[model samples]
Target: MILPNSGLMIPWLQSKLDTARYVTAGDLGGEMVADSRKAAVLIPLVLHSSGSTVLFTERAAHLSTHAGQVSFPGGAYEVQDLDLVATALRETHEEVGISPARIKVMGCLAEYFTFSRFRVTPVVGVLQPGFELVPDSNEVADVFELPLDVVLDSRRFERKMVERNGQRGFTYFLEYDGRVVWGATAGMLLMLAKSLE
Candidate 1:
């Protein structure tokens, strides 16, 4: 059966996002970065006839950090940035060429702490229809879209035990086409999926 609501307004999305229960990567036996470096990422929601899709990027293989790993378009906070939301928008624009003017900031998810040593804030935003993605050679290797339904489904994910330098814990991961979305990225996406429910 086709759903009656075809599109979501910014206000409706904002309400859901505002009340979202934020979850972070569980304790991995580390200090969890008490004075962590602040960063932000944009969960780019794109509208379509069927429903909404999410935009993600693969980091360039040549990059020193997390090279070739799939992640949302985002980066560290700069002094020039007005706020975390602005940082997310600026990085998304820089890495994917999606201008801020074409985006409507709906809401945000809970802050997530990464084992890689950064405190990341996931910002939720809706991308207007028909925005072309221009991936930066130095930052993004590829840009792709995933069905929001796929990401939102709890049944599609599995918990896997992981160890990093002897610190062991379970993490959520979803496999798509040969790529793995795990760690903090998956954790943030989990929050988004739960929020949308």
Candidate 2:
């Protein structure tokens, strides 16, 4: 089921972002002090027979930085790309083998800051049903899907405090099985949830 058009969250999110004032890039938290790079990511939502699910990938364990972590299939923007949306769609096809033609891009959500020193623009897209997936072995360890409703449910969201830079900071965490979903990825999802509301 498509969660009824009533609960389709992207419309509400678009409205909020349209009217809200955005802070300058410098004012954003979690920005890297070193060379800050620009990147784009795709939040691919698939509507399946079981339910609507969000697609995520587990990074290969041997890679440097953020290895063995669950993430959306994406990377830094490339010069050849025309725009952020193209970057996202291209990256998603390269990492997960989902054809760009199969996606209907809804719009873009807020930009997210990563601890790894990259400012990422997350493009929201809906995957057409019956599309095939071919995961790239070099970059992705495994591909998995989680019910969208479960993720949107506020009861499943939790916050934890951690000591960073001699001060305690609270971060949102989403638990599934024994795996932890936190950091920038989770933050983006939380922002999407807020927009949905």
Poorest stretch of ten by lDDT in candidate 1: 1-10
TM values, all candidates = 0.88, 0.82
Alpha-carbon lDDT of model 2:
0.75
- In model 1, which regions exceed 4 Å deviation? 1-6, 9-11, 23-31
Give the least accurate 10-residue stretch of model 2, judged by summed lDDT: 22-31
Write model 1 residue lDDT over 24-120, tens digit each, in one string: 5433522366667989999998877777778899999999878888899999999999999999999999999999999888877767877666888
TM-score for candidate 1, residues paired by index: 0.88
lDDT (0 to 1) per candidate? 0.79, 0.75
- The C-alpha local distance difference test score for the whole of candidate 1 amounts to 0.79
Per-residue CA lDDT of model 2 for 56-81, tens digit only, reads 99999998877888888889989999
lDDT of 2 at 131: 86
